[model samples]
Target: MLNLVELPDPEPGDGQVLVEIDRVGVNYADTHQAENSYLSPSSLPLVPGGEVVGRTPDGRRVVALLNGGGGYAERAVADLPVAVDVPDGVDDTTALSFIVQGSTAWLLLRRSTHLEAGESVVVHAAAGGVGSIAVQLAKAWGAGRVIATASSAEKRALALELGADVAIDSRAEDMKGALIEANGGKRVDIVLDMTGGTVTDQSVASLAPFGRLGFYGMASRELPQAIGPGSLLAHSTTVAGMWLPHVFSLPGNVFSQAMGELFELAAAGTVRAVDGGVYGLSEARAAHEALRSRGTTGKLTLDPSR
Candidate 1:
């Protein structure tokens, strides 16, 4: 049996870094990539992963957000500018989970939505990786109320444990009504939605006047239908899409500054990791299955060392 398979270990030709992966963070993107439904076209037989925590040749632990797929392995090539030093004391697992989801949440809350200290924010799939981190970050950022929507009682409890002020069973009741109850009849200032389709519509409905909605992923695996301009104008709400790759594309110190802020928050324990379980690289198929079945919460990882 071939314990290890060799693929192209192309040298970091220009502004790229060669990383020996220690942990690969599994997300909804990985599940979609495995299913051939990721928004961007992918190369066939590709290694499907978005983020990784690894060590550079200099022995420094770093996190990389790959441009394409290749994180489900022992090593990979990543853009040098997108790689950041992992904060000291932040373990490999947490570091991997924080790069993609944590940075996305941080940008959405701070830059996209411009979340105010006393405003309210609603997060969908609150028990999952991005949502869990978003909930905590929102609370730490001084959101008066953080409402999380989950599909089960267990996930709801987990969201509360992670720092949500209130958890709603999105599968059991009217989302708008549940949100109103959580916010004392006040419309939310921001809605961080990963689940598209009807959930996107509901999130739009739950926003206050002039509120902002940050759309990230389509967790439901369906393309989100358009929110008509008429409806948006009526509500005075604005909707924006967030992809971590875009943030990294900006010039100058933009990406570095954002990553620095996230690492600081993680080191201070203000944003806790929601690592659900760890699997070996050889068990990637099972990890994909677990994510597809929606049977796990928080961040799932592939430990290269087993």
Candidate 2:
């Protein structure tokens, strides 16, 4: 359904600027948005993209977040405040990763749970755009143990290389046991997961007292059963939900600060978003298919010029 079309160029509104699109960050959210199942509803003639790396009229290369979804085309309207300058010498893919996924991962640790030093942390979808970065950031930020869960052997190896102390199968029959077993037979202090359903149930059960669960996505069709106050009281656990755009609303230029730090880490090669695959503008549908298939790892990008 993501067919190529030509239309009048989009005009910028107040506080926005037109960007000549270069590279688009294709996220799992796009797949849900395409099916009209995203947190926000989609309208007719929707363009299923949210982040991109492009150049503004001033010729400055930047990575931008499109609040209302217009990143797949040759141009998009970027809110100036949400667009940040891409570091010199960074490629389009790395720059784009530093936006949505990178920012989300950083906030997950810094804000979502205020991850404490020496706390054992778990990162589900360990080889994903957000999960991949979260693993390294947690370790760099002083997590005692970083347990990663991925669906494949290759991804598990990648997570291990990215500073994860342990990697377990995400589809394990006894997810909670697998998590505790991987953590040296002890409950974890923090868990970061976009996966819902049974995996979420296990994550919640695997938490130590006063542990926190940072829920971000619903890669699985079903949601986690973690909202019961009674269960929370008994477990001494907390659930913190994260919607990336909402992070921008926090005081003190929350998102911009996080992006700046993540860029520094990425530039230093301290952390990197895994490279999934790149597709052309016309291949947007195919990209979504690959993401939903759960076989792709790291970050998937789109080249609009192709």
Best by lDDT: 2
Error of 1 at 34 (Å): 2.3
lDDT, model 1: 0.83
Q: Candidate 1's residue-wise lDDT over 1-306, tens digit each?
A: 113356776577688888998889988888777777777876666778878888888787899888787888888888887788887788876777678888788888977899999999999889888888899999998998999988889999999998888898877457777777788888888999988887888778878899899999887877666588987997799999987778856677766776787778888878888878999888888887887676788889988887
Report how far off residue 162 is in candidate 2 (Å): 0.8
Q: After superposing candidate 1, which stretches have Cα over 4 Å from the reference?
A: 1-8
lDDT of 1 at 199: 81
- List the global CA lDDT of all models: 0.83, 0.89
Model 2, residue 115: distance off in Å is 0.5
